[model samples]
Target: MGSDEDAVLAGPFWYGRWDETAREHHGGHARQLNRAARAAHYAEGAFDPDATRAAIAGLEIPVLILVGELDFSPSPVLATQLGELFAPGWVRLVVQPGAGHHPWLDDAARFGDVVTRWLAGS
Candidate 1:
């Protein structure tokens, strides 16, 4: 359904459509959510960056910090900080070229390549 034009049109983010109207009318509704929802929303009404950083710091596993080139949500600098929390060889950052919030969709091959290399090294 990701590429389905009709499906996309039927959603609330669209400027026109009955479904859009219904979605907008819903008391707790919004369209086109940001990707930061991945790391931020852990529980109801809670966004714990400190806890996230702490958990990250606690981990001894190698980490890959991939962010979209155009994403300004937490920003690339923030990703860098997260990477720094780990030991020197334990973290790597891969910024997808020409990408926004969703890097996998922006450049699938590059994302795959980074993951492949990280896994091979691990």
Candidate 2:
């Protein structure tokens, strides 16, 4: 297996509560760095922002965007922008306080409650 040290280091940025156990768990099934890099490259190349926006705009179903307050990559502001693409009341943006990229990891109970409530309401 490839070294998981890099994955462990990146865990903090991807997950709010990336502890040693989480690191080990993720690392256990981690792919080689080059393979991961290639996948990421392909994913990025395949993404089209305009197409995504058009698809989201055409959605008839309610959209719930959950963002972590502490996450910098797709910050709350970005989430807001995404929500704005949809008609008013069609998209709901919820910012989980003190959470990073992974809100469930930061606070499982609260995350579960929020998601459950939202789903129930929907």
**lDDT tens digits by residue: candidate 2, 8-77:** 6666676666787446545664453478666776785578889977888888787889999988779999
Clashes of 2: 0
TM-score of each: 0.57, 0.72
Off by over 4 Å in 2: 1-6, 17-45
Across residues 32-51, which tens digit of lDDT does each residue of candidate 1 receive?
A: 44548734655565857788
Clashing pairs in 2: none
RMSD of 2: 4.3
C-alpha lDDT of residue 21 in model 2:
48
lDDT of 1 at 74: 45
Instruction: Say which candidate scores most in TM-score.
Output: 2
